[model samples]
Target: MIDCISFFGLGKLGLPLAALFARSELRTLAIDIDRELVARLRAGQVPYPEPGLDDLLAEAEPRITYASEARGAFGTDASIILVPTPSDAGHPEFSSRHIEQACRDLCAALKARTEWRYHLIVISSTVFPGTVATRIAPLLEQLLGRRAGRDFGIAYVPDFVALGDVVRGFQEPQFLLIGSDDEESHAQAAALFRRIVAPGTPIQHLSIRDAELAKVAANVFLCTKISFGNFLAQLADRLGGADLDSIASALALDPRIGGGFLRAGSPYGGTCLPRDVDAFVALARSVDLDAPLASAVRDVNKAQYDLIERHLLAGNPRCVAVLGLSFKPGTSVTIGSPAFELVRRLAQRSVRVAVYDPAADARESAHAAFGDAITCHESITACVAAADAVLVCNSDPAFRGLAAKVAPDRRIIDPWGCVLGTHPGLVRIGRDQALAASLLASRRRKPSLRAVR
Candidate 1:
C-alpha cells in the first residue's frame, strides 16, 4: 500500500480534509506553502473554528504532521491535493489562477517523485466543468509519461462541507460524487471515499467532466428555486393580501415542486452559488450553450440583495444590528457573505451596526467584516439590546429564541425566515422583496402578523 500525502492551501477547504484522513491513522503528510499555517498546525490546532475539528486534531496529532517544506512530504505516497479554486466576481465562472497554480505545484511534485509508479492523486477542490479533462488530466499525463487509465489514477471529488457544519458533513455526508476518467481511477477513488465517509453513503462515479458539471448545475438549480420563491412571493403579495406560507403549501402538493431549499434570503453568497453559477455560465459560454434561465438565477439573486439594501436604506434606522454573517445558517465562513455585503452597503449610510452570531466571532468569519467599526456582542440579547432595528442575516436557531424576547418597540427583519412560529415585532421576509420593505415601512403596531407551525 502506498503511503498517504496531501497538499493544501485554502485553510477552509484544505485543513479539515487533510486532518480527517490523518485522523484515520494514515501516515498523512499535509503540505502548505505558508510558514505560519505550517507552524500553527504543527502546534496541534487550525486557525478556523470548524466544529469538533480542533478536538479531532488533538486526537490525531501523532498521525498528522504539518510541513512547510515539501522535501520529505512528497514521498512515494498517494497524494491528494485540495486547493481553493474560486471563481471571479463576475456572474459566470471566471477565474482559475488558483487551480492553475495548484496544478503547477502538483506537476512539480509529480516530477520530483517519479519513483512512485502507482501514484493516486485526487482533486477534492471545486472547479469549473472540464477541469479534470482539460487541465488536470493532461498535466498528469505530461508529467507521468504514461496514459491515465493504463498507468495512474485520478478522481474529482468536490468537498461539500460548509464551515460550521463541516465536521458533520465530513463525518456523515449525504453522498459522494467521484468523477473519474477510467475504471481503475474510479475504483480507487471509491475506495478512498469508502474509507472516509460513512458506510452505505453511496458513491456515484461518472466522467470527470460530468462530475464537475453536476456540482455547478446543482448550485444553479438551487439558486433558481430561491429566485422562483422570490417571484412567487411577489405574485402572492399582489393578490390582495395572501399568505405565501399557505400558498406554498398549496403549490407543494404538486410532485414536481418539492418544498426544500425554496426559502427566501437576502441573497446567496459566501463561497458558492454566485460563483458556481458564474462558472456554469462561463462553461456554457465556452460550449456555445444559451443558458438564459441559468444566467438569470444569478441575476435574480443580485436583485434580491439590491432589494434588501434598498429596504434597509428606506428604513433609515440609526443603529442597525445584524444577527448573522455566514452564507448558510450553520457556518461561520463569511467570505462573500450576503450579510457582510449588507453591512458594507449599509455602512455607506449613517448607520452604526452591531453584530452577533451564536457561533461566530473575530475568529471564524467576522473579523474582516467588522474589524473596528462594529461591536461584537457575546449574546443575541446583548446584540439587539440598544439597536433601533435588527437584521437577521443568518438563520441561527439561537436568534429565533432571542427574537421572542426582543423588546416590543424594536423591529426585526428576518431575511432567512428563522422565525417559524412568529411573535410580536418579528417580520418574516419569506422571499418577498416588497414585503421585506413593507416590514421596514410600518412602525410597531398590534401583534397581528403571527405564523404558527
Candidate 2:
C-alpha cells in the first residue's frame, strides 16, 4: 500500500500477511508460482484450513491483486519480498529454491520496468544466519543495479506467525523483529507493520543475522518445550502404566513448564515444527556441530507417528474408521500431519480408510492429495457404518459424536482414546501402555473423551 511491490511466495505466510496489508487499503499484490493456486485465490478459495483465514481473504480480496510473474507483481520499481524458508526431514536443511525463484522473478521484474528510481526491498521471511548479506543482498543488488542501502531500502523482518492462527496473529502479534540496513528503511517497515499489528506490539530492531537467528531460536524453543513434554510423557508412561494423569499434574506444577503442548495426543504436525528442527540442526551440522536437543525433538515426533502405526497394525482390522484426519482440533490441514501419515500407512495395508474432518471437504482433500482411492464420508456414522474397528486418527470434536454414535456392539480400536463408553468392540490400543494411561485423567476433563459405555 505504500507505493511498493509486495512479493510473497509460499501461500502459507505470504497470503495472510498480504491480506493484512491489502485490508489496510495498501493495493497489495501477492504472487505464487503455482498457477492452480492463483486460480483458486482469484476464485475466492483457500486450499489450506486456517481459522478465520477464509473470511480474512474475502475481506482483503477487494484491495488485493495477483499475478504469477514478478513483472506484474514486483514492477521493477519497489518491492517487499516475503519468501518462506522451510526445513525438511527434521534437519535444518533449508530449500531456498522457492526463495531464490521468487528473487529471480523479482530480478527480471526490476530489469523490465524503468518507472521508479526508488526501490525499497524488504525481506519478511525466515533465513539462516549470514543469508541476507552473503546470499540475498548480492543477488538483489546485482539485479537492481544499485547499492544495498543507498539505491534501495533493504531489511530483514522475519515472520513469527504460526500456521493455524495466522489471520488473528496479524492483529495481536507477540512482537515484530526487524533487521535493517539504515534507520529510514527500518522506520518505513515499522510504520507499515504498525498499521497491521495492534498499537502496543513492540517492533524490536536488531542485526539482520540476529533477526534471522531470533526467529529460529523462538521456534526451536517452542519445539523443545513440546518435545520435553513428550519425553516426560514417555517417562510417565513407564512409571504410571495406565495412570499418566498424575505425572502430567506434577509436571504442570513446575512453573517453568507451561501446560500447553503437555496434553499429548499425537505429535506436533503440519508444516512448521518438524522442518524448523531440521533446519536448526542442519545449520549446526554445517558448522561441524550437532544440536542434540533439536535432533531428539525430531526423533520423538517421528517416533510417535511411527508408534501409532505399530499399535494399529498389530491387531489389524479390515475397515478402520479413522476418527480425525486433521492435525488437531479447530482446523483441517493434513499436510505432514501425523494423522494423515497414519492414514497413508494404514492405506498401504489391506485396510480401507474412512476419513472425516470437521472443517475439510473430504472429496476435495482426498482428490487433491490421493484421489478416490481413499473413502470420504460426511459424519462418523457413515465412516463407522461398516468398520471392523475404529481408530481415533484426529482430535476433532466430531470424534466425541463418533463416541456417542458407535453402537454398543461395535469395537473401536482408538489409539487416541476418543471413545470412552464401554461397547462390545471398543478395543483402544496405546491405552494400556504407560504413556496412554497417564493421559487418562487429562482426557476425562474433556467432554468429547468422557467415554460412555
Candidate 3:
C-alpha cells in the first residue's frame, strides 16, 4: 500500500535515493533546505557529479517532484530523512542539529494536516548509538503529542554506500538492515525496501540502538583491515626482500583474510572510515571501556601518512607535484583526502606544491580549499612540469603511462602502483627496495632542481 515516498535532504545521497524511488514506480518528493540546489534539480541538472545519476534522474523526472520545505512531504506514505550528521568539531560524536531540525519541521507539517493516519519517518543518516532511543524518538513524541507505535512509526536504516558508486549500491546493497522498536514499523520498512533492492538480499531486523552501533562498527572494521595492511608494509620495509603484495595475496587465499583492503597502498582517508574509527573508540570510552585495537588502527593510519611524507621529503625537493586530490578517484569529495593532507604537510615545511585531478569537482574543491598556498593544474603533464618531484596518490586511470612520460631525471613517488614499466626515477610504497637506498643516497648530497626543467 506504500506507493508514495518523500526524501528530505537531497545532497549526493538523498537526491539519488529519490531518483531510485521514482524508478521503482513510487511517486517521490525530493526536498531540501537549499533553494539553489532544489532549483537545479527542478531544471534537470544534477548539482554533483555521480556516475549514471544524470541519466537516472532524467528518466525518473516524470515521477519525481522537487521542493524546499517539509510541507511537500505532507501526503506521502513515508518520509525518509537523509540529512547530514557530521562529527563534532573537536569531539568524536555526531551533531544531530540537522536531524532534529528536520524532525521539527515534519512535526509542524503533521500538525497542519486535518486527517488522522499513521505516517512512517525513516532516518537514513548516520548517528551515534542510542540517539534514536534517547533523543530523536522522545523529541518527536513530545512535539507531536502522540505515541510512536500508536500514532507514528520511526525507523533507523543508515545508508552503506560509497560516494562514487551510490546509484548502483542502492540497487544492490549487500544487505538491508531495518531497525525499529515497533514490529509493525519494522515490517513496513522492510516491505518498502524489498520492492527496490535486488532479490535474495539478506534483511536483518533489529532494535534502533543496535542498528546505529552496527553501522559505525562496520566502517571501523574496514579501517582495521587497511591499517593492518599498512603495518605489514612497514614491517616489509624494515625487513628487506619481503614484498607486501605477495604476502597479501598469499594471506587472501586462506579465505579467512579476503582481499578487501589487505593489499596496502595508501592510508584509509575518507569522510567515513577515519571518523567512524574515532567514534567507535570514543563510544567505548563513554562506556568506561578501552578500545585499544581501534586506537591502534587510528595510530597506524597516521603513521602510514607520516611514512609517505617522510619519503617524499627525503630528497628535500623545492617543489612537489601531487597527482590526485580526491580521497579515491571516481568522486570529487576531498573532506579527508590523504593527497590534500600531503599537500598541507609539505606546505607547512616550506615545500611548494602543485596539484591536479582529472575530475572537475576535485579541482574546484582543491582550488577553494588551498587558495594561494598551492597551485592547481589542468592536466597531469602540466602538474608534473611545475615540480622537482612527482607523487602519484590515487589509482585514477588517467595517471597511466605517467612514469614513462615524465622526465627521467625527476623522481616519481607512486604509492598506488598506478604507473607500470618501472624507471630508475620511479619509486613505490610498501614494496620497493630502491626507496631505502635512495634515502641513503639523498642524505649524502643535495638533489639538483634542474631535473624539473
Question: Best-fitting candidate, measured by TM-score?
Answer: 3
TM-scores of all predicted structures: 0.85, 0.82, 0.94
Query: What overall lDDT, based on C-alpha atoms, would model 1 receive against the true structure?
Result: 0.70
Please tell me which model should have the higher TM-score, number 1 or number 3.
3
Model 2 C-alpha lDDT per residue in residues 53-102, reported as the tens digit of each score: 88888888888887776667545334667766766555356656666677
TM-score of 3: 0.94
Candidate models: Cα lDDT each: 0.70, 0.69, 0.85
Ranking by TM-score: 3, 1, 2
Clashing pairs in 3: none
| Alpha-carbon shift of residue 226 in model 1 (angstroms) | 2.3
lDDT of 3 by residue, 265-366 (tens): 778988888888888988998999999999999899989888889779978899999998999989988889999889889989999999999888898888
- Compare candidates 2 and 3 on lDDT and give the better one: 3
lDDT measured at residue 292 in model 2 versus the true structure, 0 to 100: 90
